[model samples]
Target: MSDADYFKNMPHDKNDPNPFLAIYMDQSIPFNEEAKAAYLKDCSSRSRQFLLPVLRPFARLMIIVLQLYKIIVPKALTSSRLLHRVLHFGMKTFVSPSANFMILRHFYLGSEVLGFIRDNVPGVHIEMNPLKPTKLEPVKDDLFLIHDLNLYNFVINLNRELREKGTEVTAQKQLNFSSITSSRIPIEQMPRRWTNFMDLTTAIECFTPVYQLFLTDNDFWRATNSLQLDETIGILASKIIGSNDRLALINNKHPMVPLTTLKAGFRLVLHGLATEQLHALLVELKLKQQKEAAISS
Candidate 1:
């Protein structure tokens, strides 16, 4: 079934044998005994077939690398004000706008979910804090678990409404050279100021979680590195440093690049911990099924 159809047909009843409900839904109400038993059995089979073997070694390697980095890097340098400033500036100047835009989209979707829950769900208090450019925190409460699921539902419903009114979004036109030149003129004319520095720091702070999430996804990592990630890094460095000669001097030798790469790797390790947690829950469910099956047989 298509993804939209799958989500649309998701069973609301607790007794329904949908595995996604177990993982994605709030489980305040217990499922019927028979349905729970069947779900447990399904979890066991799926875990053994699809989850454990692939994830176990990946998790182990991730932990080892993170531990080693902690041992090798001094806390003082890691926390240096100048170093952080440089890193922030480098990231802002070098990272593609596409990445920044995608992260912003996630924040937007999250805000929409918060609003929906607040207006619709009775007795569930939702926090309405503004999205900080720095420091993206989790929702204050469990009122919006399964953010992606909720965002998908929100978008689908919105599109349906728009379609019923015979309205469709138009495609964006390509930007011309004149438009691009005009956009850069303002920044070129402006003098470097403290607020610019503050904005850079704030952007870094807000982007940390988005970067972590992006790095943790194995597919994204693979796709990013497929064309030699260092090559693009080199180009960005050349532009910032104003010479290919300086680029060669630093090149792949810069500590910032390695440090950022390591940070991303470490974040992936943390992601592995989350995966392990889910795997453990599935294993427990599987064992429960086995015990019940033995009792029945």
Candidate 2:
């Protein structure tokens, strides 16, 4: 999106001194008190004036409620420490607050699986093909939802682990891929639902943060890092996704490619670069979070 569009759509106060608004209104009307009064009187004379005036005020109230909810709610509500405002938008539509905690726990399992994928999976990159972007449109929504939850779980787990280990006091404020990735354990072998659909690592990457959240100590992490990929996938399948009755039905009825295979396919098709890209993505994510934090503070 263009910067102009982004700022224009952004929520702002009636009294906001935003430069974007200044530019938008420049030469059209003066923004002083007298101009505002005349503008209101003119608007009052227009048809649908009452309805139109109410719309902007109502929109502002909604924005306030949303921001307030973001500040009041816990991060686990949507499996994210960042983007709670946006994520909560989804919940307001699709999810019930009563079930938020259960969903959050499921997300944690997914995060741990993602952790394994980062360290061990063969190099496969996500090349955003402009021409072919629409080809895989069907599964993209589900995949994105899965990734969003995983990232949330990862932040929560990482923050907790860093706090417990006394590794660094500012760990919550920074990203540490090495520390997190190095702690991954191999998947435990068991009845697995994901074997047919995803590469073990790729599937795990989809949801490892959720799994990592419940971990006890360094010993558990050490043990997990050693498990075979298949075994770990199976463990996750049975304990997390497979256990959910609604999701289990979807898995059993319509098994797509295995998560392991999907990873390889994504890498081959997309042809991604190294972890350096991750650095950029992480920086953007953090900056957005910091901005939100500042707004809330």
Candidate 3:
């Protein structure tokens, strides 16, 4: 029987013996329950495989909303100005000054997720020609190669490129939002702030095209990388960076490129985490590496 027909006929209820649902429902299966459990597992996996492509569009939308919130929202919500200022100064002194604004924006959730998607998803497949894996290079030596974890950074770059060519966005970024409370019209406060923004409708209209462009870019890069559109790391890196050298090592070259399912996914999610969050993961990775090294020693 066809896979589609099989899934179509499978029971959707919680109590059904549906093998596809079993994978998600029964996480603790010590022993195989069905003769063809492996086949059932494959079906369940395929069902979720489409999620990446289908969700990519929505992911772009969420990212845009998150970026606007970050830029417009007060610092009190994300972090204290003191802490942010300290990090900003540190980043400027230690890393490239180009990365300071991004570091500040990275504190916001929208920028974190954008960084995550760019690194994790097939969205941004950077190429560093002459790829080679060597001993850990000090960040002080090549701070420009470091990743910037800010979503608004991407938006800023996008806007800069458009402006260079003389384009206008009609201040759609300053949209007001309206909120409905309890489905009850108090009538007096009829014009209360619906959303945090004053012109949300305009913002949405402006943001919509930008979101679609990101989705397209993500799809294009991933498709090209998987299909081996370019063998040179330089070309791949250029594809991912687009017109933004302020973020990645657009000038530097790599000897050994990281091109794998796991690496892609890891970079995507890691880039999405906040600075402290990324630091915590880095500590965990360090511990794991030490344990392995000790075992080897």
Q: lDDT by residue for model 2 over 1-297, one digit each (tens)?
A: 432354446676778765545544453321222222222222233222343344444433443443344455523234323333333433333332212222332233234334532332223221211111111222223433444334434434544554666642211232323312222122222222322222212222322333223222232232232222223333222332223222111111111222322122123112111121222233334456567779999
Residue 260's lDDT within candidate 1 is 35
For all candidates in order, the CA lDDT equals 0.33, 0.31, 0.31
TM for candidate 3 is 0.18
In model 2, the number of clashes is: 46
Q: Pick the candidate with the highest TM-score.
A: 1
Candidate 2: residue 248 lDDT (0-100): 18
Worst 10 residues of 2 by lDDT: 126-135
lDDT (10s digit) by residue, model 3, range 1-297 = 433345545678766676565553453322112212323443344323554445455545655554454445423233223323433333333332112222222233232223332342232332311111111122233221222212224434544654676643222221111110112111111112222121212222223333223233333234223212112222322243232222231222231343432222223322322222332232333356557779999
Candidate 2 lDDT score relative to the true structure: 0.31
